[model samples]
Target: MSPILLTVNAGKSAAVARTDAPSGLTGIDKRPVDGEVAVSAPGPRGVGGSGLAGDSIADLRHHGGDDQAVYTYAREDLDHWAAELGHPLENGVFGENLTTEGIDVNDTRVGERWRVGDELLLEATSPRIPCATFADWIGERRWVKRFAEAARPGAYFRVLRPGTIRAGDRIEVVHRPTHEVSVAFAFRAQLGERSLRPRVLAAGPALHSELYRNATAWAENA
Candidate 1:
């Protein structure tokens, strides 16, 4: 299958009664939009939020930044989860800004570059670490544990060149880093695989800053 941007999702902040969101509101309910959505580096975490203009990021401390300006998930992974959970999973249901097809998002190497449509250039940076907000939103027992064990956290991207993206945009892998550290590998390393920490660190400056710091500490202390 040809890789494509299947949908662009943006969310509005809304109250969710039982969520772990500190503000009692969450932006996990992203919905697909037909129109173009602006994409850019969102400055920094806790200060800058979602890169998508219309997207709402409730937990600024955890969600958005230049390194994680955009969250992407593969439709194939979603289908896997849907089948495992015995429920239909729709595009954007995982709170990802971009729903992609024909791309192995988890296997995408850190520092890989993807050209969306024509102008938007995105660099793969990190993997989404499931949290309480995500677990609460999903409402599945031990959802976090399950998701982590599966090691298919999808991929986060930093906007290298700001532009507009829309549903049905073609996605082309413009570059792939020489390193073997992929999003899934980094995710597993972060989840306590001490042996993989060195490999994850080898991805160098392309890695998310926090992950780099943790890997550095782990290597030093090991």
Candidate 2:
């Protein structure tokens, strides 16, 4: 895998278009190929425009973030997006903030870690469940919900350190913690009865504070 493929988007216009008000078929691949994706820092379009500025978004976690945003590939579905929009991924349909080459975003479980450039450290946090915003883009209210049921979720991050991310940057796997609990596992656990929740509770407070908060709750409930 190529490690990372950082991309910058064109602001809300691009974001909403993909998720809600799609522009119909545009390119040859079939789906919405490309519109905009944003860098952690602003781009030529600027922060409000689409790009981030001077590590501003990274700085949002000066204290710590409960979740981080990361994307991965699920080519089959992507092909649907491509085919529907007549734009291929090669055409940049996702407007993904970053299009990773090496790692599958879905594979990024909570507690996972990676190194970007020299300074910033990216770690998987809670998986991003579908939201209304996503539904707005796809034009189907259930698409977001369906995504959660189908793919489970994508990794979000809590920045361990802040720095710039660029296209083709080397994303090094620094660590993958040994744990019985992962975000997806947790959600699956929630599907029926109490199974993995107890395990998460048992892990104790050694994990990131954010996780521990959920763990603490699960422990109590379990």
Candidate 3:
């Protein structure tokens, strides 16, 4: 099936936080918005295109930046979760800026580039790391471990060209790096899975700097 955007979501303020969660602050509480949302590159240490014009990033240290400018989750994956959890899963519930359909997000290579709409260009950078905020947001026990075991952690993208994107926008894979390091591979490597760590090298400089360094170190030790 052709990849199409199912929803465009953004958070105007700090995502709803829970005192019970490990991290009290989070920006995962995104909601779908109507019409077109502007997509643009962010300034240094700034929020990127997916963040929307008035969106907020509560924790700058770990989330929001050029490398993780846009977050995408697959509708197919959400469907799986919905069946497992016995509830309807809505777009943006996973904290993704784009809810996409017909895309194998986990299988996408680390350096894949996507053309959304007519002008926006985005590059896949890394897989999202399940955080305490995510666990609480989903209200699942052992959520992080479960999410990792599922190996369906979606991808984060870096904005290449700025434009506007919305629900129903066409998504095309414009490029795919030769590297065998898919988002799932990178996610496993980030979890200290030595066997998969070497795949990170295939991603070359396309990997996030910190992740690239950590993966390189692990591969060297291996």
Candidate 4:
């Protein structure tokens, strides 16, 4: 199967659930949309949220920004989790803006650039760091620990070119940086694998600002 977008998901509204979240609400209940959805950079974190026009992100401090304008997860990963958990998982259930097929999202290089549809250009920036809200939303025991241990946190992208995206859009990798820092490796580093910090820092400017800063500070102190 060729790499393509399986679904475009956006939160319908913020729900007053997820006590683990700072806002006492969660926008993780994203649902598949029928038609085209506009995509663009949503500025900086804490102020901007979700690149998809109608999407809502309740936790602004941790999610959404120019670096995390879009979040993507693979249907394959979802399938793996579904079988492991003895239940079926729906698209967008993980709060990903895009659910992809036939792509190794976790293995993607941190600086890779993907062209979605015709004009939506997205640059891979970082991996989703499972949070308390995500754990609460999943409603599984030790979900955060399990997710982090699995080390397949999926990929987050920064929108470089704004355009409309819908289900079935083709995804083409137009560019990949020379660094070996991949989404999985970055996630491992984020999870306290100090040995991988230097390699993650090698991604340099292509890395998300926060990750880069953390890596830089670690390297300096080490």
> In lDDT terms, which candidate is top?
1
Encode model 1's per-residue lDDT on 1-222: one tens digit a residue: 889999999999898766665888888999998889989999998888899998998878777889899999999999999999999999999999999999999999999999999899999999999988889888899999999999999999999999999999999999998889999999999998888987788888888999889878877887
Estimate the lDDT of model 1: 0.92
Cα TM-score of candidate 2: 0.61
Q: What ranges in model 2 sit over 4 Å off?
A: 6-66, 69-96, 190-194, 201-211
Q: How well is each residue in 1-222 modelled by candidate 4, as lDDT tens digits?
A: 889999999995565656455658888889999999999999999899999999998778877889999999999999999998999999999999999999999999988999999999999999999987788889999999999999889999999899998999999999988878999999999899988886788888888999999889878877
Better-scoring candidate (TM-score), 3 or 4: 4
Span of 10 residues, lowest total lDDT, candidate 2: 24-33
Q: Give the TM-score of candidate 1.
A: 0.97
Pitting candidate 1 against candidate 3, the one with the higher lDDT is 1
- Sort order, TM-score high to low: 1, 4, 3, 2
Candidate 2 per-residue C-alpha lDDT over 135-171 given as tens digits, one digit per residue, 9 for 90 to 100: 5544554675566566545455555665655545677
Query: Alpha-carbon error at 124 in model 2, in Å?
Result: 1.2
lDDT of 4 at 151: 89
- At residue 33, candidate 2 shows an lDDT of 19
On TM-score, the candidate that comes out on top is 1
Backbone N/Cα/C clashes per model: 0, 29, 0, 0
Whole-model Cα lDDT of every candidate shown, in order: 0.92, 0.47, 0.83, 0.91
lDDT of 4 at 135: 85
Off by over 4 Å in 4: none
